[model samples]
Target: MQVHNRRATLTGTVDSWLDRQQAAQEAHEAGAREVNNHLHLLHMALPAATAQ
Candidate 1:
């Protein structure tokens, strides 16, 4: 994460959209006036489930 002029810039990947929103929320809570969320969502395939 990079912080300059009360703006927080987030970089890297997140598993879900919720995580991305949470990151920005945390930044705002930490006194960031502006947030530049450059987080990319990692699209990972889920494993197949076995039949019962």
Candidate 2:
């Protein structure tokens, strides 16, 4: 019974860690996408600025 309880505790900890890891990865990807979009807009504006 003690071993079973320990196993259950360990599983819960691991599951929590995995959930956090997934959340972090998703946030990082979203930030990267936003940065890329900003860069693309800047890139598009450069030609107009140079023409002026």
Candidate 3:
């Protein structure tokens, strides 16, 4: 019973970690896309930027 409880605790901890990691990955990806979109919009607005 003790071993079983320990296993359960470890599993829960690992699951939580995985959830947090996935969320962080998603947030990072979203931020990167937002930055890219802003840059693209800026490039479109400025013709001089396109020349460089």
Candidate 4:
């Protein structure tokens, strides 16, 4: 995460869409006027047993 001029820039991988939204919400709660969420969703392959 990078912060400049009250803007929070987030760059990383998240497991779900909810996580990305939560990150932005937390940034706003932390007093960030602007939030740039550049979070990428990570899709993990499930194990054979789990896939079933």
Kindly list the per-residue Cα lDDT of model 1 for residues 14-42, writing each as its tens digit: 99989999999999999999999999999
- lDDT (10s digit) by residue, model 2, range 1-52: 0123222111122234445455445545544321111111112223445553
Summarize candidate 3's per-residue lDDT along 9-51 as a digit string, tens digits: 1112223444545544554554432211111111223345555
TM per candidate comes to: 0.81, 0.31, 0.30, 0.81
- C-alpha lDDT of candidate 2 relative to the true structure: 0.30
lDDT of 3: 0.30
Q: In order, how many clashes per candidate? A: 0, 0, 0, 0
lDDT of each: 0.96, 0.30, 0.30, 0.95
Off by over 4 Å in 3: 1-15, 32-52
Report lDDT (Cα) of residue 18, candidate 4: 90
User: So what's the TM-score on candidate 1?
Assistant: 0.81
Determine which window of 10 residues in candidate 4 has minimal summed lDDT.
43-52
- Candidate 4 lDDT over 1-52, as tens digits, reads 9999999999999998899999999999999999999999998656677554
Clashing pairs in 1: none
Q: Candidate 2 — which residues are off by over 4 angstroms?
A: 1-15, 32-52
- Candidate 2 vs candidate 4: the TM-score winner is 4
